[model samples]
Target chain A: MKIYHECLPCHLRTAVNSVMTMTEDESIISEVVEKCMQTASRFRSYDSLLEIYYDIQKVVKDAFPGMDPFSELKQNFNKLCMDSFDEYIKKINDSSDRFETALKLCLAGNSIDVMQGIKMNHDVLIKAIENALKQPLNKKVMEKLKSALQKSSNILFIGDNAGEIVFDRIFIDYINSEFNKAGHITYAVRGSAALNDVTIKDALMVGMDKSAKVITTGIDMPAAYLPYCSKEFNEAYDAADCIISKGQGNLEALLEENKNIFFLLKIKCNVIAKILDHKYKVDEVVIEAKTAS
Target chain B: MKIYHECLPCHLRTAVNSVMTMTEDESIISEVVEKCMQTASRFRSYDSLLEIYYDIQKVVKDAFPGMDPFSELKQNFNKLCMDSFDEYIKKINDSSDRFETALKLCLAGNSIDVMQGIKMNHDVLIKAIENALKQPLNKKVMEKLKSALQKSSNILFIGDNAGEIVFDRIFIDYINSEFNKAGHITYAVRGSAALNDVTIKDALMVGMDKSAKVITTGIDMPAAYLPYCSKEFNEAYDAADCIISKGQGNLEALLEENKNIFFLLKIKCNVIAKILDHKYKVDEVVIEAKTAS
Candidate 1:
């Protein structure tokens, strides 16, 4: 019920569109837009995002017609927005909201700006409650969620996407309504839009604060752009009640990290779909780590 | 000087826009008319064209807001058309003309209807010719091209996308002009639109008759849609001294077929890009294969 990574696309689209609007040179903008579009198109391919972007000169040319040098940075930046958004949407639409919430909780750590953003979106958060009333809760997912709710005094929830935040709120409300004795949940947003980057502002836009504590990461993480990890993310990652990872980038980064994390997302790429032994249609998924004895 | 794929977008935009007034769908028609507002939001994710029809559930929801299925489909179909046009623009603008042409050529093996659809678009082909004239020829490709022109007494040239046929014409024209010995270059097109389908009509739409012989594939092959192996295509594929294949689909179907083919296209997928060790970008790519001789 907790909406996690589903809210990512609107934020990503907003950022890219904002950048597209601000870029002054038509040729460069066009080139950059094309690069971003090409990057976006490759999401349908069965390749890693890194492999997709690897030596992407030919693809860039396909996207941008007449190109010069200065447009390269802009193109890469535009690609950042698109790549992140694609993964964010994939995760949010097809996965259990629990891991999504867990991801947000992990990011929030203790950032107040992030929390305030979630708080402001209370009205939006309630929209999910209305939707929840309409949708029959799946017995299996609900059982795991209820158990997690029972075990944790402080549950960290990761957030994704914009519109789906309303849906995510339903999960938290359900916990509060039916299991008030469980614990307080901390919601986390991305420090910046790294693949699954969700901000407190985004959390507010979708109304996350109406039911939970919210926060953000303390540093800017770029693995979302490139595949390598940084020191800051590793330390911040180590401190969490439970880490919920959203979207492909987060999943790729954390998939082998051996952390106590739950992954929730839609399998968008053939590579991931192959990994999950699923087809390309959107579907919800959830994975929880065995609690440390 | 020869206009390559670089000149394809402007030419295609003009062609599609010219007929934008004639499209049956009002919304898609209107979207085509919007000079600068095209988006990929409409047609990006469908696995097949059939899905376009089945997507009525959400169409009614978002387009009609609170409307029922019937009313929403009625309203949204119009919107869908515009969205389709938008997606077309995105595809054309973002992809290299050469690559697009290659895709179209590969598609020609899909179905005769797809081939005919390409033939129907005359306006874009004319514009493509004008654009190709503006660019200098790639010497390396041109050399191989020149040799093909001389060595082959008869040629089988594959056609690609809407705007790309003009570039194909450049090769055909050069071959005839320089060699002056071949009977004619037989241009082949797709039978359907599965991924990358081209057809004879597409060859003619770009005025293939003016420069070479036009032929249609007999069978509809999704993974390898080539009519050449058929009675109709084999006659042409066999009679021709050499064969020219365009697009990724062709490469997918033909690359390992152990046939004699000079493949012309921009490497569009990771599989090929990785094989070539080239960064994925839109550029002229010519791969030569001899039939294990």
Candidate 2:
């Protein structure tokens, strides 16, 4: 989760993807890319890679304010997933392994970011779902999550991206229906737009707040990096008995936190993938859930 | 040839590849990458894309002294081509169009840079050669080059990369033999190691200086940017009746120069690629040798 050598080029590519979509002005593109690099160069050795991207995001925001460069992309992705929501729900409803299906569905959702390798299409989604269903989850951790959920009255589900949130809604609904804790769930998003991560508007659009109380991390970091979060999110993080941390970003920021947490995400980069000993490309998903002492 | 928006990300990737090979130390890697970014950021808007890379290269050299990060890669490519070079020559000799074959071989060689898309191997080289032969040259320009070579005695041939220089030697030899100007050729290289560009030592290694007087641009810029060239190179460039500019770097720098320059290279990027209306992605070769009347 700390800065890796490979992270440098990756940061440049991300900024390039952002500015490329933002404007066609060559000068602005050059300046924006340089600004991102210069800003990242100032990051301390202890700073997480998440902070580096967050700072770069600021450079883009400052250059062109109030315009979400990924707005159209996010909307398109949301619609793409939502268009098949009912069919997917019916498929899950009829499936023998609803929990496993929902968990895999959540993992497949993390594979939506354009900057990342995952392509956004229905076939790609179906492929990911099939792959995840066949791929074994960490059985011990899954058992632990199920065991914890049996007694837990309150839960916090930290969601990842915009379109991905639609999948999370399905899983959360499944969790509430199967485990029967509908009214007690708290869903968290970023305080503002961070990469393709969801905000309040996206959550509302997808009606993610329909079943659970929606909250913000308030830190604006890509993941829910807690040290910078507002008092409310931190209190919520402390109060939740079972926490479902979505995406690699949350896993990075909250890996060693003294709380009950489950990291449900796709291993996107080699650095973290190596750490997990996950010998798969960005196409693979993993589920690791641990309980509080 | 001017700086393009697409060029920003590419420059970062080049620096990343350089630093990745230079050292494994993450801190140093991060530092060097940032330095390259800062160095490239300082380049004036009017500077060609090649200058951006040249400056970034300086950053790498400063960090790692007396070592060409691409030295091993360059040598491997040279040896790879040189291993089958005799066979290639035989094929060219057997062909009815020795000049065209040699010219395509040279273009195929241009595909050798790792930063650029050419994979290092005989198969890739052979494939490139086949594609070049089948693909039609700018016929009008090729005819003009033939006419210029017949009328003019002295030609300045600017070489590009180290491995690609081997192919350049073959084409130059064909020019010398066919045009009966064997002693009238001067092959120019960079004064210092700029990326994978050939220096006098590399030229000598490939025996390029043996047939012709091998000279330096006397400038550390990526290509023959004559504004910074030594007095000797400028005189040679000025006096030559025809100039054969190899590689996109040379094309970017020499495009607007008022000289009878034959730009023999592949369009590597979208910015220049779009301008040429070149439909292929980094695989096609372009022959644009215009005589200054």
Candidate 3:
């Protein structure tokens, strides 16, 4: 999945947004976008469509210099999601199908992403979570996951963003309570800061320590780019019986990988939207079942 | 008026679109977009946002070599407008305020544009013209124009695109009947092909020559970049009694000029949309009165 012409504009916008967090100087933002555009144009092809974002991340890092541009945004987003933790937990507990409800909550968390440059406050997050809860989801995927857990032991749940990871922890709690003997869940987050993707520190901060074993892939990409992953993450990937990949980034990275990977994400961006044969938006919950291609 | 960061993506898209029309070879289209992206990145600033299109136009020309990328699109759009020419004329004649009716018809024609990459067929053109007529306009500007025409001569009407110019000709006919003393309405078009903008050849083909003196700026820009305009066009600009600039391109070109120009355009693009405090679209009729920065 290379940078299609449709994707170039978004890359510019995302680059602008990332640098904007570092400084108010429009000149610097403009220059950052200018450079990103130049680099993006020369691309023969990328590892995946999501690799276009790495091009933007590189330029933002160069301009800002060791600063995590989205740090404050990530913190705010985390706090925003944290405030709703009790409400979300109560909602799940109240639902008849707690497992499916928890899964939907996790899908809802995918919208709390800043990649598209939308400002997501507490109200927006709550509304998104509520909306995702109400929407119909593929029941077959939920059944498949349950059946897989019955036969499998190692479940690697790749977490996406910071605030969203709290919701992932909720799902993990539900799984642990229901399938305690089925598998041990290892939550893999981003190794470092790329966009607003969570790391081990974020997982611990969000109290994943109480729910599951949280680790990082040792690569900052929002996805598990397996080649760049730490030996620990690769070993975990190889050993995992059921791989629950979160977000479009991980979906892009592991699209063709030979594994029992259930892509649990809200369809974001046209590239993935078309691939999934769904309408393009951040709201659509896509739970695709695939074996290592 | 400088190129906004928002404009970069459109350039890439338009560049790709221009090349795609030339060949289905994705490699060529991708290469053309790549080169365009590089060229566009180096821009310190442009005269206006519209000037950025010139860069795209240059790359398309370079890649395709003498092929007018918009030629087939231009022909289809021209025919689309021509199909409804008699209908528009009849509707104008049947209207109570024929002058305003004709002006709105011309505004409606502006949507038959290629720059935004909308596929304008005959049905779309008719619907647009109808919609433009039914909507309320800034009648104060219409009143102002009537007063200006009362004192003016040499009404240098700057035409926009090929098919859309059919609507402009209808307005020209109305002006000839109403304000015959406003001197000869010299219709100026593009000297050569740039996007779907009309040239003298297009004006002659569309019968604009019969209604008024048809001339060109001897430049391929969709707008009158007065700095790059021919001596003939500049003299026409200086000597004109009143300039009825058609479309957003001409409006962008002569926004703060010394002459009393009535910008008769359907506001296109965000740059102009922000400047005029109009929402971004091609539906509204904006008749702005400006002179001497």
Mind giving the per-residue lDDT tens digits that candidate 1 earns over B211-286?
7767666543322343224677767766766777766545555565445677655554334565445644433344
- Highest TM-score: which candidate? 2
Q: Deviation in angstroms for B10 in model 2?
A: 4.0
Best by DockQ: 3
DockQ sort, best first: 3, 2, 1
Q: Compute the lDDT of residue B99 as modeled in candidate 2.
A: 75
Identify the superior model by DockQ, candidate 2 or candidate 3. Answer: 3
Steric clash count of candidate 3: 3
TM-score of 2: 0.82
Candidate number with greatest lDDT: 2
Tell me the DockQ of each model, to 2 decimals. Answer: 0.03, 0.30, 0.46
lDDT of 3 by residue, A1-293 (tens): 45466666666666766676688776876788778877776665665555666766777787777788777777777778888788888998899998888888988888657766567887777777788888887788788987886667888999888788889888888888888742388989888888888977687778887887777898867789887789999999999988899998898788778899898888776667866765445457768888755
For model 2, name the residue pairs that clash. Answer: B262-B289
Model 3 vs. true fold: TM = 0.81
Report every candidate's CA lDDT.
0.43, 0.79, 0.78
Candidate 1: lDDT of B136? 42
Residue B93: error of model 2 in Å?
A: 5.6
Sort order, lDDT high to low? 2, 3, 1
Q: Where does model 1 exceed 4 Å of error?
A: A1-24, A30-142, A181-183, A193-197, A219-239, A277-293, B1-293
Clashing pairs in 3: A257-A292, A258-A292, A259-A292
